[model samples]
Every structure is written in C-alpha cells, then in structure tokens.
Target: MRKKSVIAALILATSILIPTHVSAATPKAGIACSKAGLTRTTATKKFTCRKSGKKLIWDKGVALPQATIAVPSPTPSVPTTNADLIYVAKDQRILRHLTASDGCANPNAATAHLQVLIGQNWINVKNINFGWAVTFNVCPPEQLGKKDSLAWVEVYMDPGTTYRWVYTGEVNISNRNAQGNGISGSTTVPLPRPVIDPHPVEGGYGITWENIASRVQDISAAAYTDAQATIARNARAPTAADNFTTYLSPGAQSIDPNIQDSITLLKRTFTLYAAFPHPSKVFFVGTTLDEKDQTYAKIDTLSPGNPFIKNSFDNMYGINPNLPAGSVFTNSKCNGSDALRNTFTWPDLKAAGAILTSFCPTDNPQIHVEAHHGAAHEYAHLIQIQIYNYHNLRAAQPCWMTEGEAEWAQTAVSPDFSSYLSLQHLHPYYLTTLGTDYSVPTNTVWSASELTDYFANANKIATCGATPQYALAYSAGAAAVEALVAIGGSEAPFALDQRMANGESLDQAFNAVFHIDWAKAVLILSDVVAQKMTHVNQSDALTYQTRP
Candidate 1:
C-alpha cells in the first residue's frame, strides 16, 4: 500500500480499537423545540439552528442589516449594525448527528472557514476573532422517542485566543442546566477592529449560504491545563489567528496515547515560538485531511505574485548533477521538516498539515515513535523559517545547520524528551552513521567525509568516498548546533539564526554571532564532536521503543 494509505489504515485500525466516550451534561433533559428559538435557514428548510448571543440574527443571505442614521452625504456618522450569522435547526437530522445534540461527542471546538454567499458571489470570509458554544434543544414530552441533543450555536468574540474560554465576557445564552452542552463556551479574541466596509454582504434575494459544520469540541477542551495556564501567566501564549483539531479515529481517541502526546507537544512548541513571536504563523489546521491539504497548498506559495519554483528529480536519490539551478532538489531526505518545506513537497494536498514520518517501526521494526521529538523538531523548523523568511529565499543553511538545530529542539522542548531518546534503540539508519555508539554524547569526531555527507547535497555525497550516507543530519547535525552553543553559550545559535533569517548571508551570520567564518564554524563543531560527545551511553535503548 502507499505510505499515505498505510497511515490512513493505521489510523482506522487504531480507532476501531478505541471507544468513544461522551460527556453529556444533561443526558436526557433538553429544551423544548419551539423554545430553542432557532431561526430558519431558508424560507422552506425544516432543520434549523440560530445564533444565541445577539437579539436579531441576520436574515438568511448575504445582505446584513445596518441601521444608518441619516447624515450629510459626505459627513462621518456612527452607524449601528447587527449581522449575527444564522443557520437552520435540525428537526430530524439527529440520525446523522448533525444537530447541536452532536455535541454529545465533542462540543467546545470547531475547525472551519466561514463561507458567505453575498449576492451572486460566494465569498471566503477571513479575519474573525471569534468562536462558538452549543445550545440545547428542550424537546417537550410530546416529542416521542427523541433524546435531548445539543447543537452548536452562540459565539463569543474579542476574547484572547486561549485554550480556556475566559477572556471575553458572555455574549450568548447560558446553558447552566446540565441538560445543555455547558454553562457557556468562550473565545479568547484579540480582535483588530474589523474592516467592516471591506466586504459588505447584501442580503441574498435567492442565493444561499447554508449549513454550518459544527466545530463542537469536548467539555474539557479550552479548559487550560496547568502547563497552558503557566503560559498565560507568563504572557507567552500563541496569538496567531488559527484553529486546530486532532481528528481521532473512532477507536484511536481511546486507544492511542502517542497522538495525544504529540498534540500536547505541538501546542507547547507553539507557546515557545510565540514567546519568540514567530513571524510566519499559519492560517489554520482543519478538522479533516482535505481541509488541511488545501490550506497547506495555499500557504506554500511564497506569494500570489511570485510563487516559489521547485524541481523534483526522478530517482530514489534524485540528485542529478545535470539538473538545472535556481530550483529546489530532492534526494528524498524525508526526516527533517518544519512549518514550510519537507523532504518532498506534498504530492497529495490532502496530507498537507502533517509533519509526516518516513520511519515506520512496523516496517523497520527498530525505529520508534518519539512524539515530542518529532513535534518539537518540526516546530523548530517553523521558528527557523520565520527568523529567515526562508520560503522566499533560495539558498539555506547547510543540512548540518538546519537539521542539527531541529534535533536540538527535541531535547530542549521537554526534559522528558532526552530521557526518551536515552531508552531508544538506535534505529539501523542512525547506527550506520553514529557507528554503534548509543548515548548522544557531546564529543564524537566525525570524519571529513561524514561532514560532507551531512552538509553536501546528494550528488556531492555520491561522489565523495563515503558508504551508505544515512543522511547523517540528525546526531551529527545536532552536534553542529550544539558546538555553537558550547562556544557562544545557549543563545548563540538562535542569534545567528535570526541574523541569517533577516537577509544576512550565512557567512555574515556566523561572523556576526561567533566572530568566525562558516568554514571555521564547521571545523569547530567537528572538533567538538570529536573531542567531546563521541560514545553513546548504553542506557538509551528502551526509551524510544516504549515512548509511544
């Protein structure tokens, strides 16, 4: 099977083994259908939903209502506007879990873009500092055989973006009754005054912008963990305008722990980078693969006016010397990645947002899943990219610099991470490059050829007198960054990285941060590896295997 297919199958198989656990505040109690105050989605539709916070939801269609007090033609006037988005109620869609009752599974989160049909044009809505909550349907006793369910309604705005819904005060109906989804879900919005006049929607005469895909999340979602709370306390929380979803298979939700760990690790990394205030923040991570794929592809283009240009060689190690310049070359070095490029530009847009894995323990049976290691490593790339505006530029720091720093992030993101590496059996790939040494020590002298393998392109490595290059970009590469840290202190690598990202050449950055040329920096790291961190301690084999 294809790699993506295999992953999809793995997700399905794992989910089948895990069970769904629902946290319904009120299992049977519900509000009456008539009293739910669901605004009709259309003049003829039956299933309906509505916004609970505002007094008057906008009439279904593109045109919103704006009460403009008459003023001189050119004079500025304060105009009152109410355009709460509205949807239809679900009377019988319960069979498919389409209504607010679907909150039974997960009700506090959503992952989607707003699609508004204005007049005859379908517009993609962007830039909203808002989020949603659920509303309960209080079905009267006469609604036989129907169980109480909740539909997502109500929005909270202007709150800061937080895992917990606490920033903005209530702007919607309360659901203190356990029979409902929750007391009230909130959004943490740092709203920029909207460009309200930019895209005015004229009420549709006949067009439709109907049906909302509820982003209902679990009750515990947004409730900050102590770690996340600390981020808030420290004033280092992520502030990008984005939404995220970890789509678990039916069984994976209960059976897989690695996915959850990775998700946590991903979020934690976000906080760290936000503290740096990363430059290239993404738009969103959708609820489904398709959504992510599309978003990724859109974001991948460096700019609308000047799309990035790349080239793919036609071999396992497609390192053709004859390949043209002014384009990216791929030897399929799939391990190292970040928020932008990967080993290969994703051929499948549907698999867009994943920081994918080429190592499958089941296939190799030696490599293990280190969730935080991979997550943080990928995130570090993002930080690196922002520091450099890398996607727009052509030349990059050599593999040793890029991969080595990313590898360092694994150990730096969490203390527990190094411990995990310590227990992992060196995957065969690494065993080849590191030469049977187990522990990642600071002193290990890599040969001139090995350095070439890590820093040189495939064509150069193939010509260099080395065997099985093994992409020595991990341990060896990391050693490169660590060597910088050793000489200049912990902050040196990032300082250099920032300079490089800000249009300074590699030589300039090295000169600026370390008072040395790139040639000297390379040799210094090689010496550090040789003199310090050479042999691996025997204690790290088991950690990698059991980490997931």
Candidate 2:
C-alpha cells in the first residue's frame, strides 16, 4: 500500500481503538439545528454526537434563536462584521486527531479552519466565514466514547445555490481524549446568487479567493529551552545553509526551555486551525542555528517592527538567477541579475494598508502553512507586475484593483474561487460611491471588507477614464478590467494595455493574450457588478429608514 494509505490506515486503526473504550451501545447525543439568522435560509439542524456505544444519539444543540444568537453584546477584539455571524458549517471541515490537533502534526486540517474564521461575509446573509483561531470548550480525550468526543465538528448543507438542507457528516471528535483539546474539520457548500443586487453596501464584497494545500509543520520542545545557547553556537559559524537549518536542530548545543514550550504551545494551538482551501507554494525561512540568530532574524539590526531579515536569500538559499526579477524576499545577499529587487513597488506598499510581522518556530512543521498563505498574497503582485509591465502604464495603479486581483487570484489558484464568490455579500455603496475616498489609516478602526470594496469601486473608475482619482481609482479600474475581460475574454482590447506598456501591441499582444467571448464577458461582468450594487443599495436604504 502507498505510504499515504498506510498512514491513513494507522490513523483509522488508532481512532477506532481510541474511541471504542466506551462500552455502552447507545447512540451518542447529537446537536440540535437552528437558523443563526445570518444566512438567507436556515442551515440543516446540526447536532453533536458522542459515542454512547452501538449508536449515535442527538444531543441538545446550543439553545439560541438564530437571530438572537448573533445579537450584539460586547464587541470582540476583532471587528464584528456581517461575515462574523454567518457560519457555513461546511467550511469547518477538518480531519485531525485530538492530541495531534496542533504542531508538527496535520496542518492541512488545522489551517482549513483558520481560513474559515478569517474569511469575509456577505451582507444580510447570516453565514459566517471565520479564519485562523477558534477556541471551543467541552470535548476531551480520555473520555472518548464515554462522554468526550471531538472538539471539532462538521455540519453538512444541501448541495445547491438555494437554501437547502442535507444530512450532517460524521462528528469529527478529536483523536485525543482530553477536555479543552482542539480539533478541526472542513467541507464545501454552494451558496445562492444574489436575488436583489450585486454591488456591496458599506464598501465592497468581502470575497475569499484563496486557499492553501499540503502544508508541513515541525516544532521541537527542547530547542526552546536553550534559545540563547543555540543562537550563540550558530552565530559563530554563520554558514549560508545554517540560515535555513538551525530552525529545528534540537540537540545542536544549548537551548531555551521557556521559549521552546511557548513555541510548542503556539504550534499546538494553531494545528487545529483550518487550512487555506487553495495554496500554491509554501516557504518557511529560519536561522542557521537552533538559537535565534539575531544577525539574520526577523528582528535583526534593521527595524524592530518588520519581522524579516534584510539580506536574506530564497527561503531555501540564494535567489534563482534564471527566474524573473522582483520576487519578495525576507533575506537578500547575492545581488544576482534577477534578485528580489526592492520591496513591493511604492503602489503595492501604499495599498497593503497595514504590514504585519509574525514569528514562528523553525522546527514547527505547520509554519510552512502560514508561510504559504502569507506568501500567496505576494504572488498576485508577481502577476500584477508582469501584466502591468506589458501595458507600460506605471503611474501608481489603483490600490483596489491590484489588491483585489491579488486577493482574487489567491483563491483562484486552488480549492477554487467558486466558494468565496457564492458566499460574498456586497453593499450598493460600492458602486454609487465608486471613486470615493475611503482608505483610513491602517491603525484606524475600519472594515477590511469595506476598504476593499472602496478600492474595488475606485478601480472601476480608472478603467473608464484616464487619471482616475487615487482614492477609488483602482477599485473602479479593476471592475472595468473585469468588465473588459468578460466582454473580450482574456484576449479583449484593453487586455493589451499591460502588454502594450511592455512594448507589445494590439496585434502582437493578441498571440500572448487569453481568449474569452467579448459580448458575453461584458454582459456577465456588468450584470454581476450592477446586481451586487443594487442589493447593497436596498439594504442600505432600509438601514437609513430605521435609524433614529
């Protein structure tokens, strides 16, 4: 049998043995189903099933009215948006064991849950798209079949564009049998197309267009104990390869205990985090020695804020000379002809809103998953740079268009964008307020989805006329580009703008361009954008009338 099959068999064998401890044959209690009032229709009632022995019984669901369940109380650290209330139970899918719920274990299953938590939601629909971290109480390891089951749960919905119902999948109890142990699960579901409008209300649609696959995480407990000792030994040698290797070299020399455990805790906590539905590649960089090498660390001599080394190379080694120029890098040393030039272009940095830096254990296997998701955002930049170069139009491209395209492509490459497209809910203001100013300081409390909408709307404006205002230019221009792509397919007229800029022309660009029907494309793009906007406007009007 293949290694994967063998490993899976082992997992199944272990799970079967672990959960069978409960001798009772009664059905496990399952959760009750109720609409959260976040979606257009009620979800198939979800029940929790704990092993009662021979059968699984229905347990009382969390008792709260669908609408009342989401009633605003204390604000969460993360802003509460339309997406927060809507929980598409299917997206919570994962396959993980209880003890292996975190670190060096299965990351694909873990990050999948995280992606759901971080996802943006549509307006009116009560569906929630969460990302990264979700903590739940109850469910333990030792209790397994007796009273403990999986902390992670999965709810299956009907496969359709309308509000339909379907039976729930297996209750994913954690492989571990301890209370407060984490678990993860995932599944796919179809959402309805907009019946009312297409445009967004507060800003633009909070759409998810990216996912990650096949992540590797490795973490060590000992490495944390002698962090300083590890760093000291590695710093002396400073071999280029050490930059990448020291991360997991557990017994190299001295180690730090506290840091090591903390790293382990983080790994365990996030292991049950969901994975990105689609991810292209993952690269996790680290210091040469087990100890944190201050010389090449994210907090090196440069600035304390940005957690990246300046003269770093490819996460593996030096840059690939044959590759195209302008790739992102955490460290740069050799100045090859095709080095990861400077950081993102001025326009990209301007549009990024806020820059976030994260630290991870070099040995943590799941670290790569985060790297893939983080780096995937930059891949869109690669495309943006390439396409725009083809057009030779260099004035700061609209922030919305570039970012939106990047966001769109992240999902486009894997798992597919269909899920995000279906789940997104937009506001009308996104269209009417096209070319409006909405970007606030990154520190300011503003909605990420709303800002994206503004940027998207601005890009639409840029597509129609030259010198679209910076505020909303990118959003409008991108929409216009989408509109153009719809009409002409990928080979349409404006398609060459980037190529033309790159020194290609109407004829030459034709050969290199994609081919999509122009008429149908235009109709689809225009209709979609317009419809989204209409729905947003209606929702907004109602809010206005009800305001005291």
Candidate 3:
C-alpha cells in the first residue's frame, strides 16, 4: 500500500515539475519564404534560422526585417549608432558662408549643397546653393556690397608651377553678410596632383604677361592672388571706404597704382559733365590719355590712322568727319595739335575728332585731368551746337557762341582748365590748346581792342574765329561767357540754351537770360578785361602751362 502511494506521489510530482512543453516557432517543412532574395546563413536571425549548409554572408551593416527571413532565428546582439549625417569635405569652412536652416537669400526656407569627392575626382553631390573658398580665410570672395555677388570659387593646384591647373567651381551666395551663423555644408576637392584644368593656356587665372596687354587700362593678372589675399585680410571685400583698395585706387602703392585711379577720376569727371543740365550724348567708350613723346602703348581708337578705321568711327559716332585724303595726318603732322572736332549736322549736334593715348610723363599726374578739361570744352561745343540747332538757327551771324561756351565749359570741368582763362587769374598770359600746336618764335600780345575786333568781325567767327592776325578772338567770347556765368549764376549755359530751344532768337534769348545784348556783352566784358590787364601783376611768356 505504501509503495503504491509513493509511485502515485512521484508521478504527480514529475507532472507538476515538467509542465507542458511547447514547440519553438521555426520555418515549417516545405513552407515558402516571403522575401525574394531570402537565403539562410547570410540572413539575420531576427526572423530567419541559420541552420546547416544554408547560403550565408553578412551585408556589412544592412538591416533585415524579422518577418522577411525564411526560417525562424534569434536576433543578433550587435549595436547600431544614432549619429547625425555629415556630407561635407570642408565642412566648417563652408558653414562660414552659409545659413543653418533658413533660406540664405530668403529667410523662411532651407538650402544646402554637397560636393562629393570620389577617389581622385570631384563630383557634384547635392548642389543647393552652397559657396566655397579658394583661400582658407577672408573666404566668401564675391559678396562685398549691395548686388556685388561673385558666384564662383576657383582652386589653383600646383599654383606655382608652369603646368598649372585650376579647379573652378560654383560658390553659393546668400544674404548672410558672411555671418553664416548656423550654416552647414561641404565641398570635397579632388587630389591636387591631377588638377582639373578648365582653361589650358592661361589656366583660367594665370598672371602671365598676356593678361596685362589684353585687359583694360589698369587690370593685371599679378593682382589676382593679391585680390583674394586682400579680401581675406580685410575681413570684408576691399573697398575705397575701408582704405584697402586694390587696383581700383589701391590704398598702398604697388607696381602701378595711379593708372586705374586716374582713369576712374577722369570718368567721374565725364559723368559730371554728361549729367550737366544740358546733358549731351558724348560716347566716351573708355578713358582718354594724352600721351606725348612716349608711345609705349598705342590706342587705335584715338590714333586710328587707317581710312577704314576713321570712317567706321565716324559712322559709329554719327558724324561726317573730315581729315581729308591727302590731309590725313600721322607722326609729327597729326601730333601738331589735338585733333579738332568738326560739326557736320548742327541739328543733331553730331561731331567727330581723334582720340589720343599717352604716358603723361613722370613730372605731371594732372595731365589726365587737364586733357579731361579740354575734352569737356569740346563736349561743350557739341552742347552749344545742339542748342543752336534746336532754335532752327545756323550760327551764321555770330559763330563766336560755339567757342565762347566751350571755353566757359572748361572752367566748370576742372580748375586746371581755368589756367587758360584770363578771368581766372586776372593775368596777361594764358595757355590755349591750339596755340601750343604752333612753333612760333614770338608771343603775340593782344591789346583789349584786338581781342574785341576778333569777335566783332563776323567773317572771322568759325572755331574761335581764328586767323593769323586775330588768333585770340575766342578769348573775348570766353570772357563774355564767363561774365554771363558771373552775373546769371553757374547754370547760365543751360538756362540760355533752354530759352533758345524754346524758339527764342539769339538776341531774345540773351536779353531774357543774361539781360544783355550780344555786342554789349562782348564789348563790356572785353573792356573789363582790358582795365584789369592794365593793372595786372603778370608776365608775358610764350612758355604756357598745358597738358603735353
């Protein structure tokens, strides 16, 4: 009975300890896997089994879903990272010129570009609107001031070698003012040895001798690296305000400094005249240089000796120019005087003349300023011709009006011009453009009456009414115009022209604008000049001060 009880107890205990065994979940025999590329040992055990003789290999770090595995397997214990995505080569440098999230030029959007480098080659990965730097610092080269944007960055690998190659790439610009506070992006550059040369001969940005020859007046290839270095040093682009100017009026001196600035000042003076109340359309394609004796550089536009060239220039400028076939000049003949601009169509005020270029000697930098003043005088003639043509009157009776206003125009251009005006210095001697063309041994001192007679005689009235006997006739006219400016104010020329443009006769216009008649205007001004000349403390000299 005890044995029977013990056997029952043992059986009951065994049943309670073992519990009910359940089969582990695994792929059933002949069951198909849901995934197409399903393989055994190579797959993850998360949901697939790694049994014997099954195809197998690890996919590095590729993730496999549990349900996609063919056979049931245990999940792997390897860890995975949660780091942020980084896609830049020059990550921080690029961020120095980009925005974090907001739109760069705009403020409410995001922009990003990633340039990738694969082995020895550079390839565009994500080109949103990112900018890069050729130099490590002062970096964003193109965005200086308002609307001043440079959208390219070029790299000169093996920069100092003869076989130079440049890797020019696009720069992304934004309105960050280069603050680039939260900007993030990258530019992957290729290996330097195999530099990608965009332009072969010059390598796109080489500072060779050819660049100086072809570029406009002051631009030089040697200045290229300096240009970038200057930007980096200044923290902002080099500007006149910062006093760190490069070729455009460089602050500190270099190989050549004044040439570009000289051109700039001349052009600025040109705009001042062009914007004068009676603005004339004078096409000065570029700055003019009056080089005398030194012809190291030739400007074909001004010294175009060929007839085809001259005729082409005439057509381009709306003028019927005459440097007659046999009369056309070169060398000393043409150098006798500045090419005189002649008028053919008074109505349209079209005129033409030779433009010259020069070195302007080491002694005088102001030669350019003086020549500009002279050009202004010529332009004034154009303005006056337009005025007279507007009134439907051919200045037949008193042609002195043209030279008179032009002389006055010189003073308005620059004080350098005033040296030629008798009224400016109240002196006995004055320099004139045409006067220098002569090699006369004697100085012809004109009495006040002679000056008066030059303008009074109607026949000697074209182009300052110049004749062997009365070369200074226009001096009286110049004085008269100056007197008009004195009494009526600086705007007298335009005001007088406007009156004539409104159909007023010359006499009517003079009376209305200057409150004086033509004869009296000249006679009175000349008389005043004579009285001043009598008491003037001045010398009479043939050696005058004019730009060579």
- What lDDT tens digits, residue by residue, belong to model 2 across residues 1-548? 69999999999997776534432233223422122221111243434444345544445434435543665687546412242354343423311111112221222242222223323322122322312211111222222223222122222223331221111223333432133333333222223211111111111111111100010000001111122222233344422122111132232112212224322222221221111111111122222322334434543433334432332233313332212122223223322211112122232232211112123334543333333333333443443443443112222233344544433332222222233232222321121112222332222122334434444444332132212234232233334333333322222322343443333322344344533333333333444344333333353422321110
Candidate 3 positional error at 407, Å:
2.5
Q: Between prediction 1 and prediction 2, which has the larger TM-score?
A: 1
Q: lDDT scores for all predictions?
A: 0.35, 0.29, 0.35
lDDT at residue 335 of model 3 (Cα atoms): 32
Q: How does candidate 1 fare on TM-score? A: 0.37
- Looking at model 3, residue 114 earns an lDDT score of 30
- Residues 1-548 of candidate 3: C-alpha lDDT, one tens digit per residue: 99999999999987755422101223333333333334333244433322233522222233456675478689765322112332234332111111122112221132233333333333333333334212111121234212212122112111111111112222234332133522223222212221111111111333222232222112211222222222233344222222111111111122123445333433323333332323222332222122221221222443344343234334222243222122222222223222323223222333332222222233444544444445456555545544444222222224445555666555444432234333232332332222322222243343568556755663222222223322232444554554444444444555565554443445666776656686666555555444433333335221232221
Clashing residue pairs in all predictions, respectively, total 64, 147, 9
Residue lDDT tens for model 1, 442-516? 423335445543454421211111223333556556655544543443345666655544434567667766676
The full ranking of all candidates by lDDT, starting with the best, is 1, 3, 2
Question: Residue 505 deviation, candidate 1, in Å?
Answer: 2.9
**Candidate 3 Cα errors over 4 Å, as ranges:** 1-281, 285-321, 324-367, 390-397, 415-447, 458-474, 497-505, 531-548
